[model samples]
Target: MGDLEIVKRAIAGDDESFLLVMQVNKEGLYRTAFAFLRNEHDALEAMQEVIYRAYKNMHKVKEPSYVKTWLTRIMMNYCQDQLKKKKRFTINETLNEISIDDGTVQLELQEALKKLSEQEQQLVYMKYFQDTKIKDIAVMENIPEGTVKSRLHKILKTLRQHLTEKGEMDHV
Candidate 1:
């Protein structure tokens, strides 16, 4: 069935249809959550809360074509709330990874991402990691598109400087 069909089903109280939505987007949402929260357990909790909230409020959504955007908006809010509720914890020296290619590069990239502030990390993750477009990210983040571009540009510059200062980049 098409995405619209699924959305209609979900709105009509098909819990399993909601599950399908969650299943399709769960990995992306989890990774996005991880990018912000940085704690696996907290990310999981936030994602769960997001899914639950989405399910409860599915009826409020008026457009069938906006399911993806709507879901991401919910995820972003859940993450922000989670951030506010939890006293932030410092990440340990070591970060985890599951790279298919160069582990060194992956580790460094993860380290660089961790160096970013939470909002910047989320912007980077949504833009590149989840392959989200700037406009969509802006909507999901409830920010202006120009702000998204500026934030992403700033994030890239920061990451480049950080990697260079740390000797990860020689000619950046």
Candidate 2:
């Protein structure tokens, strides 16, 4: 079965097809959850919650072809909400404490990503981290495709500047 057929079946309440959908998308979903939550435990928790949410609301899916995007958007929103609650309870950590100059590119990139607004961060995650297509991102975000492209270009520039300013990377 193809993606659309499988998604349609899943939406139509086929348990096996739903499981297949979850199985196929698990890794990518986990990575997206981890990116936002910043730890394995929280990522796993977020994954479970998102799975529950998606399963409970499967019938709300309007476009079977965009089922993956819909799931991802759920994960993103859930993570964002969790982060908000976490921030409300925790003391704010300074940049020096949150960022480490450990010579790892990934860590540096993550630190730079933190400088972006939540919406900007989501755009980056959808476009780069999840490797979602621009048109798909536009649809998920309910924006024009041209707007998505412009935002991504601006986000990349901001990230590059942030890295350079922090001495994490040389000017390109």
Candidate 3:
């Protein structure tokens, strides 16, 4: 069966379909959580919370075709809330424990991304890290496709300027 049929069943409160949908999307969801939370424990926590949230909100889904995007948005929102809660307690310490898998260039790019506003960061993460289509992002954000493209252009310009100023890049 196609994603649409599975998503419909899931939304219709079929337990098996819900579990199957979660199973198929788990890896991508975890990766997104890890990218935001920056640790294995927190990512797993975020994943569990997302599963609960997805189950609770399954009926709210408007488009079965966008189930993955909808789940990703939930994960992102949960991770962002968790980050906010953490910031309230801890002094904003720099995260130095870069994953061994991440390259130096990736680290530099991450630093640049940190300079962006939360909305901009989400836009970048969805478009680049998750490889979400521009139309999908537009749908998720309730913006026009042209606006998504324009914002991305501006975000890339800002990132290029930041890297250039830091001597991480010789040219934009």
Task: Tell me how far the alpha carbon of residue 61 in candidate 1 is from the true structure, in angstroms, after superposition.
Answer: 3.6
List of clashing residue pairs for candidate 3: none
- Give the distance in Å from residue 106's predicted Cα in candidate 1 to where it truly belongs: 2.6
lDDT of 1 by residue, 1-172 (tens): 9877987898888998888878887887887777667678878888889988898899888776667767776787677676655535534322333334656666667678767886776677667876788887776667899999988899999888877777734545
Which residue pairs overlap in candidate 2's backbone? none
Of candidate 1, the 10-residue stretch with the lowest lDDT total is 90-99
C-alpha positional error of residue 106 in candidate 3 after TM-score superposition, expressed in Å? 2.5
lDDT of 3: 0.89
Model 3 misplacement above 4 A:
92-94, 100-103, 168-172
**Overall lDDT per candidate, in order of appearance:** 0.75, 0.85, 0.89
Total clashes for model 1: 0
Q: Over the full model, what C-alpha lDDT does candidate 1 score relative to the true structure?
A: 0.75
- Residue by residue across 26-120, what tens digits does model 2's lDDT show? 99899898778867888999989999999999999988888888988899989989988987887764334434554567677877887899889
Give the runs in model 1 whose Cα sits over 4 Å from its true position: 30-47, 60-63, 73-102, 168-172
How much is 65 displaced in model 3, in angstroms? 0.5
